[model samples]
Target chain A: MTVTLIGGEMLHWSDRPATPALPPVGEITGRTLVAGPHPHDLIASLPAERTTVLLRGLPDAEAVAGLGVTVWAGSLDKVAATPAFDTIVALDGLDRLCSAEAETLDGWDERLAHLLTLLRPGGRLLLRVENLFGVHRLIALPEALGDSEWLVADDRDPHRPAGLAALRERLAVVREYAAYGDALLSREVLADAELSGFVSATIAGALATTGEVLADPAALATRALRHGLALELAPAWVVVTGGAADTPDAVVGAKAVAAADPPRGRTLEDELIAAAQRRDLPAMRALLTAWQKSPAAGVPAAQVIAGSASPAASDLTPLAPAGDPLVALSHFAAAAIRGDIAHLWPAPADEAELTALIAGMTGREVEPADVPPLPSRPAPGAVRELTAERDRLARELAEARAKHEFYEQQIRGRDAELKRVRQINAVLSATAPGKAVLGGLKAGRRAVRAVVKRGRA
Target chain B: MECGVHHANHYYGHSAVLARYCGLDDEAPRIQGYLQHGWNIGDGLAPDHEFVPGVPKFLWSERVRRRAWSLGRRDVYVVGAPWAYLLALEPAAPAEREGTIWYPFHGWEGQHVLGSHDNLIAEIKATEPGPVTVCLYWQEYRDKAVRATYEKAGFRVICHGYRGGWWKDLDPGFLYRQLAELRRHSRVASNRLCSAVFYGTLAGCAPAVYGDPMQLENEKSAFGGQARILREWSDMIGAEVDLETARRVAVAELGADRLLPPAELRRLFGWPAPRSTAAIELTGVLTS
Candidate 1:
C-alpha cells in the first residue's frame, strides 16, 4: 500500500523539520515503523521494502510515499494494532501526533505509553520530550498563541514526568542526550552527564545565534552552567530505549553523531564574573590581560573558555561578526553590570565606567565613543519593570511637587522675616539714639575704609 | 517654572553658577530640583526649611545622599556643589596669594551663635603665619563690636556679601566674590568643619579646622553635629592638615569629581537643549 488513512488525517499541514531528534540513519535495520513525520533523506536511507512510515498529516504522508516506503496517514490511535514493529521513532514528541478532528489521548504520559506498546520486543523507540523549564522557554517573551495550538496541551499532567530524573525513570532508559536550541532542529546535543561549562557555553552560543529574543539566552545558559543545572534546564531530551544498536554520546551534525572528548574549564565570562563578585582586582586584571592577549579576543567573552593555560574560543561559531577587542570587553563589562552576575564595581559604576575600568585593567585606554552601546533588548518581565519604573517616577514627581510647596511655604516664612527685619530697621532709624548709632556705624566704616585706602596708597 | 525655589537655590548665586556651567546665558532656568545650598552634615537642605515631599534634593555628595536615604528621604540626586562648578568655570591662575582667611562659625537666619571672638582671634594669631583676614558672616560683620574686635586686633575684616534671603537680594556673584577672596588667601581656616573650610580646601587653599566650634542657639544635633563631624573628618582637622588628604576629602564632600558634562547637567535640570544655528534661524524667522 502506498498510503493508508483509516481516519482523522489532517490535510496540507506538515510538522516542521520533517524529523527532529533523529538517531543516526545507520541504526535503522530490518522491518521498521516510523510513526511520525521524518526527514526525506532518513526515509530514503531506510530499508523501504520492509519499513513503514505513519504520519497524521496527509501531505507529509504523501511526501514520504515517493521514498518507496509504505505510509499510514491518520492519528496515532488509528494506526493498525495487529503487527508490531521492529523499530519505532516518535522524536517529534507525543503532542503533535494527534489530529484536532479525532479523540486524542488526554495526557503526555498516556500517549507515550501507547507508543511504547507498538514496539516489538528488543526493538528501539527514540522519543523527544521538551523540558518546560528549559533556557529557550525561560528567556522567551510571552507570545500570542499560534494557529496550530488550537488545543493547548495542559502540560500539568501529574502522570507525566517533570524533570530529567522523572523522565529517565518513566522511560527506564540510561541513554539520554540533552538537546539545545529549538527542539525541531537542535543546534547541539550532548550526553547529560558530560555537560560542562564549555559545552554549555557552546550550547548557549547556538541558542542565541538566531532571532530577536526577550533577553540574551547566552547569559541565562552560562548562569545555568554555573549553578550546575545545565542538563536539567536543557531545551529537550532525546532518549533511546530498547535495541542493542549502540548510541552516540553526542550528536554534532546529521553524520558526525559520535561522542567527542568533554571540554573542561569555565568560560571567561564566568571567571570574570566570579572574580568581580569576590572583589579580587588582581585576579580580574590578570584574567582580562590573558583574555585580551589571546587570539580569540575578538570573540564574545561568553563564547570563550577560560582554561588554566590560556583563554580559548569554544567550537560554536559566533553568530555576529568579530568585533573590536575593546568592544568585546565592553560587552562583557555590560553583561557583568546588567546580568545576574553580582555588581562589579565597589563604587557605583554604570556600563561606560565599568567598560573603561575593564579596559584599563588590560592596560588599554578606551574612549567613550569606542565603547559599544548596550543592547536594548525587550526585557523578559516587561510589565513588572514598567510598573517599577512607574512607581519610581511617581515618587520623583511627588517629591518634586512637595519641594514646590515647601519652597512656597519657605517664601511665605521668609517674607514674614523680611517684614519683621524691615519693621525693626524702621524703628531703629525712627529713634534719636538709633539714628546716632547708625550714623556713627557709617562714620566708623568710612574711617576704617579710609585708613585701609591710605595704607594701600 | 520658577528658576529659584526655597530662596536657597539663589543663596550664594548657586543657580547662577550651575546655569553658567550648563552653557546657558545669565538668565538661569529654574533648576528642576532643590539645589543643595551649603555643605551641611544634614541632607544638604536647611533643617528648618520644611522639605516639600517628593521634590528631589539635589545633594552635593554621595555621603549626603546615603544619609538622606537613611533619614527616609527619596528622589535625592547628587549633582556636586555649585561652588565646585564655579571653580571649574573660573580656575585661579598662579598668583602671589597672602594671609589666612579665618571664618568664625556663624548661624543661619533662625539662630544666633554664642562664642568668644577674642579667644578665636588669639587662636588665629597664634596659628596663622601671615596677616589674617577675618571673613565674618554678614550678620557678624554688621555687629560693631564683632567688626571692631577683628579690626582693632590689626586684622583686615571683610564680608562676602549677603547669602540672599527669600530670593530678593540674591547676589548672583556671591560665590564668585568668595572664590576670588579664597584664592587670594594662602590658607583657609574656620572654627568649625563647615562649608567654608571645604570650599577653601577645594579652591586650592591650605585648609584648617580649629578653635571652639561656637554653639548655635538651640543647635539641633539631628545630623551628628560638630562632635560627629570632628570625629568623622579627623583627617581634615588641625592647623596644618595634609593638603593631599584634605583635597581628597573636599573632592568627595563637594562631589567635584562627579561633575556632569554641560549637556548632561542641562538634561538633568530640564533646561533647554543647545540650539542649533538652523533651528535658531527657523525660530527667528517664525517670530519675525
Candidate 2:
C-alpha cells in the first residue's frame, strides 16, 4: 500500500479549471491514502481499497498504518517522524524548502552529507530544487511581487493612496521591464531599511505572502509536511521523495496532485506581511515603525496591542517603572474629581481648625526670601569664558585617555617582542663555537709560558 | 584584453596557442614542456625525472645546461616543471646564473600550479638573480606557491597568468579520427575501457597530445572505465616514448573545437563570444 501526502485547500481542488484527469485506481493497485486538511470528494473516486486519510493540525500516526511505504508530501522535514518506508515520493520538496527561506537554513551541508543515511543503500533520494544559479529566481521575482502586493492591498488597507501608487509602480516596472528591474526595488528597499535601523521592513514583503499563501488549507498542509520532511521550518511547497529502490512507478500517479499550477505571483506587501507573521519580532517591529513613518501611516495601536497580547511579544516589551509615580498621581486626581475624596483622604472634618491654619499662614505674612541666587543674568562675555573653560577641560581629558591607551599598547607589544628576541639570543649564545676555540688558545699559551719558566730555572 | 581563452584547462588545447603567441615554434630550442607531480615528505625530494630509472641525471641536466652554455650562454633555461628542485641542486654554475628556474608556486592540483607553503616560496626566492612570477589562475584554485614563499623570504614577487586568449584553434577531424582509432585499437585488443590505456595508445600512435594527467582521469572516468586507469596510463606513457609526442597527441584529442563545436562549446563554457568563424576556419582548412 502507498501513502500520498497532499497539501493545501481541497476546495480549490474541485474549483480549479485546469485540474488534470485522475488516473483510475486500477493503475494504482496499492492501498493509497491521501492525507491533508481539505481532502475533497474529488479524489474519492479512487477504489475503496485505497484509503484516504484527511488530517488537520498535527498528523495522525495511525494513518500511516497498513502502508508498505510512507511518502512525504513535501520536504524531508514534513513527514511526521516515522520508520523508513519501502518507497517515498517527493515531487518537488527540496526546491520549495530552499526557496521558502533563502535565509535561516544552516547545516544544509551536513544534511546533504547525511542524505544517503536516511535511505537504504539502494534506495534513491530524489530532489528537485529551483537552481539558485538558474534564471527561474530572476523571472519569478516579478510574479511573486505582483501576487503578494494584490493580497496585501486587498486584506490590509484599501485607503492608502501612496501604497496603491507604489504598488502600481512596482507592477508596471515588473510587467514592462525585465525581472532584474523588479528585483532592484526589493534590494533598494531592503538596503534603505537596513540603513535606517529597520531591517524587518525588508522581510515584511516576503512574510505577507507567506501568510496569505499558507491561509490556503492545501498549501499549508503541503508546506507543513514538506518542511517536516526536510527538518526545516515550513516554507512554500516543493516536492521531496526518498526510500524508493530506484524511481518508483507509484510516484508517477502521485506527481499529478503534487504538480499543481505554480503560485500566481504574490506582491511585495504580501511577502512583508508573511515575513512579519513568521515570528521575527525585531524585523516586524522595525517594519511597523517604518510603515508608521511612511506617508500612508496609521496609528497601528491595534497592532501594538495584538503584538503585546502574545506571550513572546510581551517578553519583548520594556519594563515598567517600579510603583509608577505618574500612575499613582493620575489615580489620586481622578478620585478627587469624582467627589470620592473620602476614599483617598477624609474631608476636612473640622472647618474651624482649617480656618485657624489658614489664619496662622496669613499672620506670618508670606514674603519672598532675599536669596542672592539669580545674579541678574550673566553677561555674554562671562558666559563665553565659562564655555571655553568647559571645552578646554573636555579636550584635555580626551587627549590624556587616548595617549594613555596608546602608550599601554606600545609597551605591551615591545614586551612581547623583547621576550622573543631574548629567547632567540640565548639559543644563539649556547650554540656559538667561539668559546671553545678561545679556551683552547688560552691553554696553549699557558703551556708555552710553563716551558719557558722551566728553561730559565 | 581578451582573457576568455585562458580560463580553459590546458588539456583543452590552450598551450599550443600560448606557444604560438609566445613565438616558441621553430625557434631556439624551447623548454621541451612542463610536467608536474606531487609527493609527500616520505617520497624522496628529487625522485627520478627520467622514465628509465638508471639514466644519468647529467643526461637530462645536459639538455638544459648545453642550451644555456650556447650563444655566449646568455639565454635562460626557464624551468617550470616539477623537477626544477633537482635542477637547482646541479653543479653547473653557468646554468644556475642564467637558468631562471620557475617552480609553479601553486599545488599541482586544480587550476593554480603554485603552492601556498611559505617555506617553499622562500626557498625559491632565496635563489638570487631569479625572478619569481606568481602564476594566479583566475576562476581556478588559489595559487600560493611562489608569492607565499618569496614574501616570507623578504623577496618581492610579480603576478602573472591573467591576460587570457591562450587557447588555440584545433581541428575536429583530427580529434574524431584519433578517438576512432583509440576505440578501434582498444576493441581489437579487448582492453578495459580506461582513458589511460586509450591515452597511452594515442601518445604512441596519434599526431599530438596535450593536457595533464587529471584531464586523462576526467575523460576516462566520465566515459566509463576502470578507476585505476590514471596510474596505469602515467606509467605506460612515461615509458618508451618522449614527452613531445605525448603532448601532441593530447592536443589533437582534447582541443576545444575538436571536442565541441564553437557555438556549443561557447554556450557550455560560458564564453563571452562565439568563435563561429574561427572554428569553421580551423575545421574547413586546417584538417583538410
Candidate 3:
C-alpha cells in the first residue's frame, strides 16, 4: 500500500487517494519462480506467462494451478536448475530451507547464500517474513496465540522472524521497509484508504477491523521519507537485496541500509552525501571528481572536497596503488584525523590539492592546523631483538605442551587397555572353560613332578 | 520460515482441519509471537521455536500446559487444541462407519516410532482385528513396503497418492473426500498420532492408546512423546477416546470461551494475503 499525504502534518485519509504505491508482484516478464505456498500475494502479483510456482504441499496446488500459472508440485531443489531465475520471491514459507529443516538457526545465512547462487547475475531476491512483534500481538486473543511454549516463553528466534536484523545482515539488504505502518496508530496504508469508518470496514479488507483507526500525524511517513523507516514497528519487513558483487555500486555493504528513495531529481551534492553515509567510495569519488570540475564545487567547495575526495580509510584496492592520488588522499585523511598531515600529497608541495581533498572527505572547511605534522617514532633495534627471543621461547613451550598432550593421551589409552585386560581375566576365571583350563594345567604340573620322581628312583 | 512442523505427514492436514472446524481460513492461523508447533518437542523445536522469535504459549491439554510452565513460561493456558474443536461438531451415525482402521506409526523413515515398523505390522497381522483399513503417511506412501507390509498381512489399505506431503493442493472438495474416507472407520489405532485418529474419532470412532515409544526412548531417538504436548497426543493413539467428552471438556474445561474471533485473529496474525503493493514496482503487473 502506498500513501502520500498532502502538504500537512496530518493525513486526512483522503490526502493522496490513489492506490497505494506498493511493489506489484508477478509483474516481471522474465522466467521467475515463487517457491513455496500461495495466496502468497506475491505470486498473483506476478505475470503468469513468465512465472512458475513451486509449491511445497499439495493443499494449495489446485488453486495455484487454476490461476493458469505453470505449477510444479515438488521442491525447487528437486526440480529447478541453478542460476535459473531473474528474480526469486521467497515470501511466505522459509522453514523449507535446509537450515529450518535441520533446526539449525545458525545456518540461516548460509541457506540464503545458497539461494543467491540460484539467481542470474544481478538477480533480485526479495525476502518477506512476518515480524514477531507485529501490532496484532497486543490485540490478539489468547486462543489465537496458541497456548504453547512460544506464547509464554522466550520469543526471539531467528527462524520465526521476530525481526529482520539477521536477515538484513545476511542479504546485505539494499532496502528494508515494513509494509504496515505505525502499529500503535494504524493510519492509511495508501493514499486511497479512507480512515473514516476504516476500522468498521478494514485496512486491507482481510485483517479484522480494529474499529479504532489511530492517527499518528505523519510521524512514520516522515521517517520513511528520510530513509530511516522503522522496520521494528511495521507489521512485516520486505527486503530488496542484490547478491554480493565486487563493484562498489553493486555491493551492499554489511551495514548498508536502503534509505527511502528520495525524489528522482537529486542534486549531485545530495547524492554525494548519501554515498558518504553508505560508504560507497566509488560513488563518492565519482561525485567528488565531478563536483571538483563543476561551478557548485566552489560554493561550499571546501565541504564537498572534505566529504568525498580525501582518503578516509585504507580499504581501497587494485585501482589505487601506494602513491596514487586517491590512495595518497585517503592516507592523508587518516593522518589528518590523527592531527598529522605530512605527505598528504607527494613531497607535501600540493597544499591546495591537499586542502581540497580534506574538504571533500570530511565535508568540513580546511584549516592550517588541520594539517598537523607527523608524530615522531622511536628506535626499534633493541626492542625488536628482545621481542624475537621472547617469540622463540613461547613457540618452544607451545610445541612442548603439544608433545606432552600427545604422550598423555597415549598413556591414558594404555591404562584403559590394562584395566580392560584385568577385567577380562577376572571374567575368565568365573567361567567353566577358564576353570577347566586352570585345573588341567595344575594336574599336568603334578603329573610331571611324579614322573620326574619316578625317573630319579 | 519452514513452519517447523514435521512434514509429508498428517501435519499438513492440521491447519486444514483447524480451519475446517474453527471457521478459519484454510491457511494455518497466523498467530502472533512464535509458534512452537507443539511445545517441548524442543529438540527440533527449540532453545526456542526455531523459525520465530515468539514466546511459547499452549492451548492444549493440562499435561502440555504443565510442561510449558515447568519450562519457566507463565503464559500457559489450557485452552485446548484449536483443531480438537472438530470433535465438537456432530459426526455421522455408526451405520456410516465400517469396521476398525489401523494407522501405523511413522517416523522420518519409520525410524523412531519404533525400532522397526515391521514389528508392529507383524504383531497386528497376528491379532484379533486382522482385516483393518490402513491409513498411510505420505512418506510411507513412497515406501512400497509400508503399503506392502500391511497388504501382506491381509488388510485393506488406502494411502495418500500425492507427491507433495499432506497439505498442498488441498481444496474443499478434496477435504470433503478425505474426511468421508476417514469417517468410514468406527475404530482407529496407531503407535503415533496420525490425522486419521484425530478426524476419525471426531467422526465417531473409538481411539485407543497402547505403548508410547517417545516415552520409552531417549529425546534423540524420538519426537513422538518427547514434548509434553506430543506425549499427550501420542498417548491418545490407543486410549479410550471420549471424542464427545473431550470436545465438551475442551470447550468448558480448557477455557474455549477465550477463543479469539476472526477479527481479533486477523489483527494478531500474519496477513490473510500479502498486502504490499511494493512488489508491483519491483517487477511486473498481473492482469487478474
Candidate 1 per-residue lDDT over residues A226-308, each given as its tens digit: 56666788777777777534665455444434334545456677777777666444456567766777666787777665653
- Give a tens-digit lDDT track for model 2, residues B1-288: 111111122332233222222222311111222211111111111232322111111111222323323523221211122122111111122211121212222322333332234444444444424343332223232336434554555543333233222222332122223333333221111112222223323323321111222222223232123344334334323213445544443333222112212222222222223222332211100121
Where is model 3 chain B poorest over a 10-residue stretch in terms of lDDT? B279-288
Top lDDT prediction, candidate number: 1
After superposing candidate 1 on the true structure, give the runs of residues whose Cα lies further than 4 Å from its correct spot.
A1-54, A63-71, A77-91, A98-127, A133-159, A168-457, B1-4, B276-288
lDDT of 2 by residue, A39-106 (tens): 23324444444333333222331233233333333323333433332322221222122112123222
Question: Which candidate tops TM-score?
Answer: 1
**Residue-level lDDT tens digits of model 1 in B1-288:** 542345567788888888776656664357756888888787777766655554456888878877887888765766688888887777578888999999999987657988888898888888889999989899888999989999999999999999887657878888888988999998999988889999998888999989988898887787788888888999999999999999989998998865655544554465654443122111000000
Candidates in order have lDDT scores of 0.70, 0.27, 0.42
Best by DockQ: 1
DockQ of each: 0.11, 0.00, 0.00
For model 1, report DockQ: 0.11
Give the range of the ten consecutive residues with the poorest summed lDDT in model 1 chain A.
Answer: A182-191
Instruction: Tell how far residue A155 is off in model 3, in angstroms.
Output: 50
List the TM-score for candidate 1's chain B.
Answer: 0.92
